[model samples]
Every structure is written in structure tokens, then in C-alpha cells.
Target: MPRNTLVNTGLNLLGLDYKPLTVTIAAMEADTHFGFEQVSPNEKEGRVMAVFSSVADKYDVMNDLMSGGMHRLWKFRMRQCSAVRQNHVVLDVAAGSGDIALGHLRKMGDTGRVILSDLNGPMLHEGARRMLDAGYLPGRADCIQADGSCLPFADAIMDCVSIAFGIRNFVAIEAGLAEFYRVLKPGGQFICLEFSRPVLPFLGVIYDTYSFHMIPQIGEWVTGDRDSYQYLVESIRRFPDQKRFSHLITQAGFDLVRHENMTGGIVALHRGYKL
Candidate 1:
């Protein structure tokens, strides 16, 4: 039941070429989902970290190009739902490229603090660099390499926790939600902006075709990494719909859970309060 043997079995079944490697099956236990397939918990984390590391340099520009700037609007909408105030302490988990953190900093004025964290070191470094380049002083924001499921902060300390387009990548999303709930103070807000199932049937069909077919090509052109983009598309498809995701928020000790669909449900903004 070695990992390589399992992979080779699949290749043999599918009539595809197989390459040998040293990774063991003990590292993959079929206990978690990585993209659309089940993988070991440890394997999923390494794979996800590798994906972000591979794309860190070109992530921002490629995001603008791929989403046609709609990601900006989505982040803006997430910020609006945050209702952040001056002196608030916010945590932006999986804050790749610092979009949500930057938006929160602008609203927080001089006294607020935003911590940008990601599992991938390169992504966190890139986000911190972007914050510095934008004239945000070192005091206004801090960057840390951390996992969403196991946040390193104290309990009930953050005023707001926002994650944009990052939750679906979690190996154990419910664990992440629990961590978010634990780190947020009573009455604090949790906002998530992420890809979701499209409401319009026709649009969903077209979106699926374009995402599966064109996105990898775009990723190749932009970052020379098609497999990473392919994983992203598959992960989005495998994420729960809004209703189910709302249930998860409630299960994690959040109250007043609600979600707003945007761009015909191509993306959604989910908000909840720790009460």
C-alpha cells in the first residue's frame, strides 16, 4: 500500500505512464481531500504548499488576468462585510498576495493591526513584500507562515478573521473553521470570499468548461505551471455549496451565519459572528 504503488496502480488502470518515487503510502492515508481526490493529511499539506510556492511570484498578476479584476471587487465586498474599525486586530488567514490585508489596513487607519498568514513561506513573503511596497509601515501589518487548521494565535484575540479564496484549499476545512472560531473574540466577525457554484445553470455549464479547459492554459502562459492551476479548478468544483458551507460555520460555534452570492454565484461572501 505504498503511495507510489497506489499511484502506479491508477496509472496501470488508466493506461498511463508511471514514474517511480520514494514517497511512501504511510504519508498518504486516504484521510483527507486534495483537490478532487482523497489523499493522506500530510500529503495534502505538502502538495498545497508546493502549489502556492510554485505560483507565488506570478500569483497577483495572474489573478488579475484570470478573474478579469473581479477578484478585486470580491475582496472589496468581503472588506465591506468585515465592518473593521480603527484599532481592531484582524487576522487574514491564507492571505496570499495581501489583497484582504491591504484592504483592511486601509480601513483600519493608523491604529489597527492586520496579521497576514499562509502555510506557504513564499506566499507569506510575497504578501509581506507587497504590503511594504504599498507604504504600509512594519507596525501596521505582520506576516507569518502558519496553517489555517492550526493557527498560532491565542484564543478569542482577533477582532475579525477574513480569508479570501483560501478555505477550499484546506486539507481539513472544518478544522480551519474551528480554529477561526476559537481565535475570534466574542462578537467578532468572520468573512470568507471564495469561488462557489454558479446559480445560473447556463452560466455554470459555460464556467465549468472554461475553468477546466482554459485555466490550465492560462496558468501555463502566466506561471509556466499548468498542474497547479488544474488543481485549483478541481478544488473549486469539489468545495461545498453555500448552504452546506454555512452549516459548517454554524457548527464551528459561529452565529448569524449568512452568505451572499456574487457574479451569479461564481463567488460567494460568507459572514458569521462569534456570539
Candidate 2:
């Protein structure tokens, strides 16, 4: 089948249209399965690339709306924690909108270099355009199409690797983590910013309600596409919990793995070192 056709089929299978009957059928089918096999890395990458490509123009706006501009504050905090400095070489995987890369440049000065990478061509194109509009020199930043699970850079080449709100979309989280470890210099840091379940039971229930109900409505009103937003919520729900994710990082060769929950665990930042 043609790629677009296949993507549409997959979306249908996921019941993105918010039809009550379709959702009921999908849930019944899923419950019947004993255990689900994880989607292949390539398949997952394709889904992510297609989704982001279709939504690239609205990506930043949706983020601002959904997070109420708190995403920026969270990213700023990540930069400060990263301790990026002059002459440091940085790799930003899935660097959507170039926000974190721009933040690093602002702090690290002209001597530092940042490579902003994403698997989706449209996202990279938009990111490059935004960088140029912001007066960033082409030499100071490199925007490329690359998969996080298989970074193209040489091993041990980067001082820092960061992914903000992007890690959970990886086709194979473990492979991506291992790639982060491989690309980092010894003692180099690996950092991820992603959504996490709220810890308090009451808060968790409230958050889930909002995510499942209100988020899709907002997505339909704002983006004219509710399916993508629904998928976003499902993917987050399916992602590993904080402790399991931290353990996966350690298994992938990161040491001293630790995570900090932010905004009542609505978002969390996980950090580790290559050493």
C-alpha cells in the first residue's frame, strides 16, 4: 500500500475520530490480547514522522496552548541544569521548534555548537526557518533529519544530549537511550523532558480526565485535527512510568540515573551520565 494510505489505515485502527462506537470496539479488541508486542522501531519512527510532518506548522502553537506557556519555563530550567558553557558541543535529538537548542545557544554563547535533529523533514524545515528568522547563523547551528534510535554522529563526540518532550515518541525507547549514551563523551549528560503521571491519586484522576476529554476537544478547535491529539494522549498513557523509565536508562548504560517531577508530575525531567 502507498505510505499515506497505510498511515490513514493505522490512524483508523487507533480510532482517532472519537466515535464512541469505534472506541468501544478498539478497547474490546485490545483487552482480548494477552500482551501487546511493542511496535517495531522502524514502524514507530514512521508513525511519528508522519504525524509530525502533518502537524509541523501547528506544533509550537499547540504546545503553548496545551501547557499554558509552562513548557518554556520547563525548558529553561533544563538548560540551567545542563550547565552548558562556551565551546561545548551539544546534540538535541527530536529538536522540535529549536527551543532547547536556542536556549543552549543563549547560555553557551557563540563558541558553542548545537546540532538540532528530528526524523520528520517538515519539522526540521520549520525549525531551520525559525532559527534563521531569529538571527541564528547557519554555522552556529546544524539542523538535520535523523532518527533518535540511530544517531548518525560518531561515538563519544558530544558533551551533552537532550530531548525535550520528544523521547516518548521514540520507536524503541531503549535503542534511543543507548544511542544517547553512545553519542556522548564519557561523563557527558543525557537529559529528557516528558509527560509523567501525576503522583497524588486525586490529582492523577483530575489530570487523566482533562487529558482524555478536554485535550482532544481543544485539539479539534485549535488544530482542526483531533486524532493527532488523541494519539498524543494515548502514547503518553502507554509510556513507561518514571521508575521503569529510569531503570531503562540505567540499563542502556547511563549511571546515576535520576528524575525530577515538575508541576505536580505533569511533566518530568530525567537525567543521567554516560560515565
Candidate 3:
């Protein structure tokens, strides 16, 4: 059986209903942003999950084709910022296809533990499959289905928490950051890699055209799903810029917060610490 399958089974046996609880809590709040539109917080997760589930099988391929393999370089930059130690414990939220988790594993020697987590079961399954194919020992990394706003782990247990291109999809970005902060050990790092406002003057025009037009077209051609990728592009536009997001990180009780823009600010890597 797949690792994610075991994790899900354990969740079921424990009767932990993370999704509905998160949605219910979010629904109690005011309207939240979902892509370019304002939607009930309860609706955002379902919509995001739908998108991930639809693309799980082709996610890796789409990443390569969409970014021309630049995402690998971007993630490598994130790893450099992470400075993961050999025996540290890392939690990768919204792990997706496990690219970030795999990088963490490579740096974290045999004793290190990497928890690959995602809210969508299918995506976690896909991530686990990739981990196995990469020859990762079964115990070196564990798969978990979890909510970013409400991680099941106890406080101050993780050495580092890293999220890539995933925070923008959260119903409540602050809430998710708070949860991430809660799980980190003292002086632990929180590294977020996400799309940011493009800095180059004319690049925005070209990027917008490609995102709004070519992206959905590519999604339709590759995954037979256009709406999901459309949402993806819109969400990038809707997400807060680097300075604003760094502020959010600080608000979540992380100190020494800072961010570095990559590729002329098309993407940014935000770093903070629980001091």
C-alpha cells in the first residue's frame, strides 16, 4: 500500500476530520479571496482541492513544461536559504509532487525526518510515488494529509517548516502561518517560496498575457483541465506581494523576517524564524 494510504487510514481510525473543521471555521469568518474572486472561506479549500486532484497525475510534467524547468532552480534557491542540517526534522506543507521534500531529504542525512504533507490525498499519493521512485528509504520520509491552518503536530517539534507556491491557496494565510510557527522549535526557520509581483517594467505585460492566455491553453492541452490553471494564474495575481507577505509572517509571531525576490521579483523566497 502507498504511504499516503497508510497515513489516511490512520487519520480515519483516529476520527480526525480536518477538512470539514477547517472549512467550517473559515466559513465563520468574512468572505475570503479565492483566485481573483471573493468567496466564502469554506468554499476555497474545496475549489483548490478540486484543482489539485484534477492535475495530480500530470503535475510534474506540467511544472516542467510550464516553467521550462526553471522551478527546479527556484526550489534549489529555496534549499540554499533553508540550510537544513543533517539531523533536523522538516515539515513540508502543501508538498505537492514532493520536489521540496526531496531536496530536504537530500540535505538531511539518514537521521533526518521529512514529513511530506498535502491537503489533497491524490497529490500526497503522487508525492509518495515519486519519493519511492527516487529511492528514498521508507522511514526517511513520512506522508501525511494535513491542513496548513491546523497541523496535527504538537508545538515546537519541528526544526524547519517550508512551503512552496502553496500559501497563496490557503483560505486564511495568517492562520496557516500561525500553525506553521506553532510547530517550529525555537530558532527554527519558516521558508516560503511563492510567486510575487514581477519587477521588470515590461515583463508584467508579457507575463500577464502568457498567464491568462497560454497557461489555461496549456493546461487544457496537457491535463484536459483549463479552469484549474486559470484559477492558478488568478491566484498568483491575488496573492499579496513580498513586503505584505513578509509582514504577515511577522504578524504570525516569527522574528527576523525577510524576503528575497528571484527572477526580477517574479518569485520570492520569504524567510522567518521563531526566536
- Per-candidate TM-scores read 0.88, 0.84, 0.91
lDDT (tens digit, per residue) of candidate 3 on 1-275: 12122363322322333333543275338888778888887688789989999999999999998888989999999998895899888889999889999999988877787888888898888988888898774767778877777777667788999999998998878888998998899999999999999988999899999889998999999999999999999999999998999999999999999999888888999999999
In model 3, the clashing pairs are none
Q: How accurate is candidate 1 locally (lDDT)?
A: 0.82
Top TM-score prediction, candidate number: 3
How well is each residue in 71-146 modelled by candidate 1, as lDDT tens digits? 8898888887787999998889999889999999999888888888787777878887888898774667777666
- Pairs in steric clash, model 2: none
The candidate, 1 or 3, that scores higher on TM-score is 3
Segments in model 3 whose C-alpha atoms lie over 4 Å from true places: 1-28
What tens digits encode model 2's per-residue C-alpha lDDT throughout 1-275?
A: 11111111112211222212332223223211111335544455556677787778999899888878999889988988885789888888888888998988888876877878887777777878877887764667777566666565667778899999888886557777877898788989998888887886699888889889988888899888887788788788877888888999999999999999888888889999988
Displacement of the residue 226 alpha carbon in candidate 2, Å: 0.6
What is the Cα-based lDDT of residue 39 in candidate 2?
56
RMSD of model 2 against the true structure: 10.3
lDDT agreement with native, every candidate: 0.82, 0.75, 0.85
lDDT of 2 at 176: 79
Please report, as a residue range, the 10-residue window in candidate 1 with the lowest summed lDDT.
1-10
